[model samples]
Target chain A: MKFTINRSKFIKYLTDVQRAISSRTTIPVLTGVKITIDKDGLMLSGSDSDISIEIYIPVADESNQLEVIEEGGIVLPAKIFNEIVRKMSDETITIEVGENLQTSITSAKAAFNINSIDVESYPNFPVIDSNEVITLPTTLFKQVIQHTVIATSTQESRPILTGVNITIENGQLKAVATDSHRLSQRIIPIEVPESLKENSYKIIIPGKSLIELSKIVENQDTIEMMVTQNQVLFRAENLYFYSRLLEGYYPDTNRLIPANDSTKLTINANDLLQATDRASLLSHEGKNNVIKLTLTDDHVELSGNSPEIGTVEEALNYIEATGDPLVISFNPDYLKDALRTFGHQNVVIGFTAPIRPFTVVPADDNSDIAQSFIQLITPVRTY
Target chain B: MKFTINRSKFIKYLTDVQRAISSRTTIPVLTGVKITIDKDGLMLSGSDSDISIEIYIPVADESNQLEVIEEGGIVLPAKIFNEIVRKMSDETITIEVGENLQTSITSAKAAFNINSIDVESYPNFPVIDSNEVITLPTTLFKQVIQHTVIATSTQESRPILTGVNITIENGQLKAVATDSHRLSQRIIPIEVPESLKENSYKIIIPGKSLIELSKIVENQDTIEMMVTQNQVLFRAENLYFYSRLLEGYYPDTNRLIPANDSTKLTINANDLLQATDRASLLSHEGKNNVIKLTLTDDHVELSGNSPEIGTVEEALNYIEATGDPLVISFNPDYLKDALRTFGHQNVVIGFTAPIRPFTVVPADDNSDIAQSFIQLITPVRTY
Candidate 1:
């Protein structure tokens, strides 16, 4: 391939695609990025078996400053290619493929000839049909991903728990994730084409894939999501992201949350987060890393103690508290993560008992706390 | 131990002393920081045997906003104490030591009760007489440390090579360090007090200790240095930095540098640095990571090749070239490190042969290359 491209534009897209290339892949050719130049444009792709990212630069897009002198394809080592592109000083770089599958890259006064693998050695991008598509604004999709992905299990022993289940039920799009100890659910209303309303999607997408997709979808106003029985594709302008679906059935978590509350407290999210963060400092060296919270008529107190290190006590004046007075202990790290997901100024916390999980949601004057975004944390036994 | 001090002031001094506290030290008490409050001021100290840092905050120092209410001392766990001090929100924090070594730290709405060790359990700070001291501007001392510390050996097999050798001959002060592969030397002239004019000293200071001392001596006009038989003390204002000297005989590296040159090339330091940096990319993935340079009458070409990866060639226009045209191979990392040490815009490179070590010096029209500063790199036998 003999092509000249804008250095900055190429570098930006290459960086985005490089995130999908894993260094420890068993397939050696998967470590390299495939570059193809033809009459349409230049396509760069990278995959690590689980996820694949492809970016296209159209020939007619003058903003990218791309020129096609010849048409060919090659796969270059991703690590070295990324290093060279990031350090190139010239505005434009020219690349040409020659004998022995060697590619020459020249810019300003620097020229590099890198050995490349045959393009045929790369795995083919799986065919994904764009017939049934769900379209949403990039901003809304990003918000949903951030709200629930944090609760997914990092341990791969339970593969289903490592994914965030995205489902469409009765025209409502919701994403839920739980790692047994905590759960996060986000619900949003989206518009779907009338022809595809009969079909619903309940696919479990790995949390790691959604994190990478959110970063790659920047600069686009809207995203088109295409789902199949085994794969999911998200298209953002000239970029396409594909991820394999987790095969196991996700555990039903609806019955896990309690229906009634014994006590409820309304407090500022930032104040509670800071108090718990400080209290956790003393408890972190302990085995359980548990912090206790007690509510009284006038104030709420958070405390942590360790035998080796001493104790810490932080008190805050809650907005209001009703129902029975309560005392409970839980992992402060889980509570911290739950508090960070709330965008509202005040959060309503509900407790059934010290042994059962508690619920946290954005405080609303008129609506029920269960309808919108909710996070649940299972308290640890401190005794 | 029992005092209310400005939170920000305490945090700054605590951070400086915390660097000397190592988690892997065999002595358990060394993991804690000793805080002593007396009629004069408050002292914070931490040590890991190799280096000890002590910072004193006087009661009357308005800049530090310190106030001592009682006279006592105790040692608190360094890791937990540092974390708590960093997160304190109140303008002033009150710390009181109660019965059974229970220390209470209170600020605004946060309170922490931490266990502490008796002050007697902490090791005593070695007293070094200041009668024979060398005083120099902090800026100049920092420059000398930076110029030679990078060449010290990181491997501890030869403990002597891990320290920078400092020598004083007449009124000239010189520092040199080498890892056997490359050597860096810096020399400067300074005025000595008449009482110490007759004595010449040679000492080796651990490179790690000098690094920490450089950071602690910031914003000071002058620093007092006392070199004893086996230790060095650097006192900057209220901060005293003490480090044990490495005990061994330093090798004589003077004979390793060649006196004559077969080829001499004058080139822009930045241009040469950037070219070699790019050429090293392909070679970095190879076994030796060596880059070759060819000096012709017109230009200097830098090239690197890997049998599996391809090749890179970078050429730069030199200001001038004299002596025989030559080709040489060396580790690009060593050349990069040597070039980075030269603060001058242009440098003169001298090569005795393809297999011998080469010298790089600041470009001078009339002075000899060996006069001010010099760096030597041993070339690899590419043939």
Candidate 2:
């Protein structure tokens, strides 16, 4: 294989494909990025068993300035090849396969001759033969992923909880994730096919895959999603991302959210977030890493204490406080993560008891989209 | 003790002092910052035995807006205190010593009550009682430190090599550092005291201390340096930095520099630096981490090979390559560091033999200052 392209433009595509490659893969060939040059364009593929990414640079795009001297394929070591390309001292670079499977990469007066693996040894990406496709707005889908992925369990003890449960029905897409102690849910609207609109679909995608997909699809306006029995593909204009689906069933979290509250507090999310951060500083030095929030008819206060570090107390500024007085203790890091998703909007926190879970939702949310999002956290038993 | 000062300005002094405080110190009191408040202003001090820093915020400085309420002293935990002050929610923060050695730090509505240690337990900074002072230009001295510190040995095997030898005679101040394999030396003119003109001074300051002093002295125009029997004090307008002297005889490095060469290569420092960086990428993956430079009457080329990986070759662009044909191999990282000190200037590299140490100096160095700076690197024997 032989080809030359604009160095900077090629680096952009290479970085996207590299996100799917892992050096710790058991399959040695999986650590290599497969490169193919055809009459249409150049394609780079990388995978680590669970997730695969392929980006294409079309020859029709004049900016790429792609010149294909010969059409073929080869797999090079991803880590070193990327460093070589990044440090090359010219605006353009050329790569050619020589005798004995040796590849020469040249730019300016510098040349690097590296060993290459046979492209035929690389594993093939999973094929999705289903015609059913679901179109999603790039921005909205990214928001859904960011909001719920935080609640996904990072521990592998319960592998199913490490994935977000996504369900589509009646043109509304709902995503939920819970790690037993905390839960987050977001609903967004998407265009469902006529035949699939009548049939409901549910899939559990690993949180890591969703994060990588969100980053690569940032520039695209919309993404086309196709699902097979064991795999799902998210397609953009020039990129194809595939992820394996988790086989086990996701736990039901609807019953975990409280329907009523005995005490409520309304405050700006950013205001409470800063106060929690300050209190957390002390708690983090302590053994339990927990902070307490006390609500009364006349005042709202947050406090944290570490036996070795002393105590911190802050009289928080809140919009309103009603119902019964309550004191709740929880891991401050959880609340900090949940509050960040609400931005600067005012959020209403509902609490039923000090030992039970509490819910935080947008205070002035009246629209269907805003009302459909909620974050719940289970408080620690300080008593 | 009680005082209120501009939070941002106070933080600046706190950060400087905290640099001298280390949590890993054997003395627990050394982990705390000593704060002494008087009618004049507030003084913050921290020490890690090897290095000590004291910064005074005077009431006369309106920018500080420092208001002293009482005269007393206490030592607060450095790490947590700095964090609390940084995260406080007001433009000005008030710190007051309450009953029972508990200090209350208040800003806006947030309050943090932390335990404090008796100021008497903190060690006192060393007194450098020397009438002789050497005045050096801030920018020039900083440049001297940056150029020589890179050659200082990071390994503790040769403790004396970890410090830079600084000597002052007549009106010239010279600094030199070496790690056995490489050496860097720089000399600049400084104003000597009238009484000390006939007396010469030599001291070895730890490389780590010089790096920290350079960072904190960026805003000052000139710095006054005083040397005592066992300590050196770097005094600015409001800051005092004291470092312990390394007690050892520095080896004479002047005899190691070659007075003549059989081969020379002249090239832009940045151009060679970039090419060296590219070649080093492959050598770093190999066992020896060395790159080769071949110089002939017609061309100069650089190459690196890794038995398990591959090889890289580049024909260097040079202004001149003359004398006997030669091939030398050395660590690219050492050359890269030396080249960075020259910036974009054209440098003349002098070589004698394949395994002998070579020197790099400014090509067009006509000024005394430029001619006084030189970097030497010993080549490795590949055979």
Candidate 3:
């Protein structure tokens, strides 16, 4: 492979693909980024066993900086290649395959002769049909994923729970994730025409994959998401992100949600988040990591206790009481996750009882804002 | 105890004191911060076995805002106290001890009642003698610690090697740290005439302790250092940092450094660091992390390799070449550490050979600037 390309452009693509490169990969070749130069452009690929990312830099960019002399391929150590390209002291860097499998990279004040791996040893990436694609605004997709993915279970006991269940039904895209202790669901109500709505499309994407994909995407462009039975592909302008889908069926969570609550409290999202945060400091030290919430005729009290350390009780003054006052204890971390995921200006939390799960929804009377979104928090026994 | 103080002021002190508190202390009371209330002020104390930090918030500074009715004391869990104070929902937070060893923390729309431990269980901070004191610009002390501390051996094989040796003689502060493989020496030329000049003192301050002390002293302020036989005290404005000095005689490192070398290379600090960094990406994966620097009549080449992975050779454009051709291999990490510690813009590397030790000094025309500091790195045997 012999070529010269804009340094920043290569660096940008390297970063995009590097997210998929895990230093701890069992397969040695997987740790290397496969670089190929064809008639059209240059391609950089990085993969772990789970996910692979590929980014392309076309020769004909605005800078007219990429010039190709010979089209070939090589697999360079991902980390070394990345560092060399990043530190190249020129606007454009030149790379040429030398004898004994050496690849020479030259710039202004530096020249690196690196040994390249045989591209044949590297595993082939999964190829997908390009036709079945769902397009969405990159920024909106980022927001929806950010809001839903945090609730995904990090525990590997149930691998499927580590993924966010994304479903498209009736011109709406709803993403739901839960660890069974708490759940986060966000419905992007952006109008999709009938042709773009596919009824058979439902897939669960790993939260880690979604996070890396989110990093590779830009707000200015539209991202194409193509879902297969086993894999999901995200295609941006110059970057392609691929993630493996969870095989098991996601739980039917709709039945577990309560329709209405006997007691409800409305509070500023930031204020309640901060209060619960303080309550969490004490509860976080507890074995169950549970914080107690007590509602009375005048105010609501948030408290937590660690048997060895101490107890903390914080009262929220802005309380509107209607039904019999309620006191419930749940994981402060879960509640924090719910509030953080929603990131709404104001939220209304409705409680059924101390043992059952509670519901937190947008305070504004717009179900559209709360469309397919539902978070459930199971109270931990604090007694 | 009852008092209300500015939230920001309390948080600042809490942050500093938090540095002295560790969660894994063997002493249970060390996990708590002692809060004492008096007619003069409120004292917050946090300590680990080796180091202790204390801050006093005077009542008069509150300008009538801080109201203290009762004078009492308690040891609040350091982490909990910090979290509560940080997350309190008011501009001014009021903390008061309630009946039955409970502490009540009140803010605008919130009130936190936490359990407090008896103050008697907390260890009393020893008062070090303040009669012998040396004062210097905080910047100078901070720079002295920063420049020489990196060379301290991380291994506990020899406890004394893990501490930076500070020898105050003839009004000059000489700092030295070495891991046996490399040594960093820095001498201050300024002469301050006082008791500091009359008495010469040498003490080994634990590397970790100096790091903590460096944190307390801001670059802007002048700091006072009080030396006791067993402990060294660093005082800056409102914050006082006391650390127990390591007891042992530091080994003489002066004999290891060569008086002169036949071959020397002057290079840009930033460029050489980056080049070695690129070489390091491969060398770090090797056994001894060896990277070779080969200086020819024209240029310098940095190369590193692993038997299984590959090799990388980066050529640096020579600014000027006059010394005899030299080839030397050293642990890239040690060289990188020494390179980072040298604050000079350019570095002059004095070399002997592949198996010999080398010196790196500030590349300055002025003799005084170069004479003040020298960093030595021992070459590794790649064979």
- What's the distance in Å from true for residue B24, model 2? 0.9
Over A121-172, each residue of candidate 2 has an lDDT whose tens digit, in order, gives 9999988877888889988899999999999999999999999999998889
Clashing pairs in 1: none
Q: Estimate each model's TM-score.
A: 0.97, 0.99, 0.92
- lDDT, candidate 1, equals 0.88
> Global CA lDDT of candidate 2, please?
0.93
Candidate 2, residue B23: lDDT: 99
Best by DockQ: 2
**Better-scoring candidate (lDDT), 1 or 2:** 2
Candidate 1 structure quality by residue, lDDT tens digits, A7-119 = 99999989989999998999999999999989889999999989999999998999789999999999999988988987777999999999989899999889999989999
TM-score of candidate 2 relative to the true fold: 0.99
**Candidate 3 chain B lowest-lDDT run of ten:** B363-372
User: Residue pairs in steric clash, candidate 2?
Assistant: none
Regions of candidate 1 where Cα sits further than 4 Å from its true position: A365-370, B364-370
- How many Å off is the CA of B292 in candidate 1? 0.9
* lDDT against the true structure, each candidate: 0.88, 0.93, 0.81
Better of 1 and 3 by DockQ: 1
